[model samples]
Target: MDIDAWLWWLIGAAVLGIALVITAMPELGMLAVGAVAAASVSGIFGGGAVLQVVVFAVVSTALIAVVRPVAKRQRTQRPQHATGIDALKGRQAVVLERVDGSGGRIKLAGEVWSARALDPGHAFEVGQEVDVVEIEGATAIVM
Candidate 1:
């Protein structure tokens, strides 16, 4: 076969490989491989070499433009809002000590946490059931 035919065959093989990789593990490199394959095929078909380069450039650019926004949107759509003590709000806790206008300790979700009384002068005894009202920094507000 001619060199051009061989180049075209190589391009086809590359495209097939890229498609398989994308099907198995859709990653950014697959887009680059596809663009290279397209450009190689364009070159082997006797299209202007500049045209082949332009085709590759345009394809890669468009793929990046389309994929980035979709990936970003998907990432943003999943919520990762609350963690640790932040997740304790609205849950019941057991006060371990009295919050003497400062802070005390409480047992929540099987873990001990620093807690403060939302209402001043509201004394809590050990094992007293309290509601977790809010979390500020490293402390939880109890009621």
Candidate 2:
């Protein structure tokens, strides 16, 4: 009926491992690593329960504070290539309405889109093809 402190740390490590797998949380994995470190302190060094707990706390906090931000930054980095509406630029669209500097309509990417001529004096008649130059909000600037 006398369970060792190292045994408790091992049990905690196992539970934290399960939590990390089930939740897919990096923080839990960090804490689990800390638990293992604490187990080593309790067993290898014959450290007291308080010292084991202190090691666990310090290791876990350091991992969460230092590594988490780097992980998050790497995760949030933008792709090398453009996507979505940005990809529409430099592509071709068919003028559905008379397109002028003011306003018009076009068929782009199988959808109807509001359009404008890139040049102030330029105009595109219906059924003519124009190259998309840019997108400003919901409007496509074409030439």
Question: Using lDDT as the measure, which candidate wins?
Answer: 2
Clashing pairs in 1: none
The total number of steric clashes, by the backbone 3 Å criterion, in model 2 comes to: 0
TM-score of 1: 0.52
Model 1 RMSD, rounded to 1 decimal: 6.6
- Report model 2's TM-score to 2 decimal places: 0.59
Error of 1 at 83 (Å): 3.3
Cα displacement (angstroms), candidate 1, residue 5, comes to: 9.6
Q: After superposition, how far is residue 76 of candidate 1 from its true place, in Å?
A: 5.9
Q: Write the per-residue lDDT of candidate 1 for residues 12-95, one digit (tens) a residue.
A: 557756766767544445455545656565655656656656666676577667877897798788567777656778999998
lDDT of each: 0.72, 0.95
With a 3 Å backbone cut-off (N, CA, C), the pairs that clash in candidate 2 are none
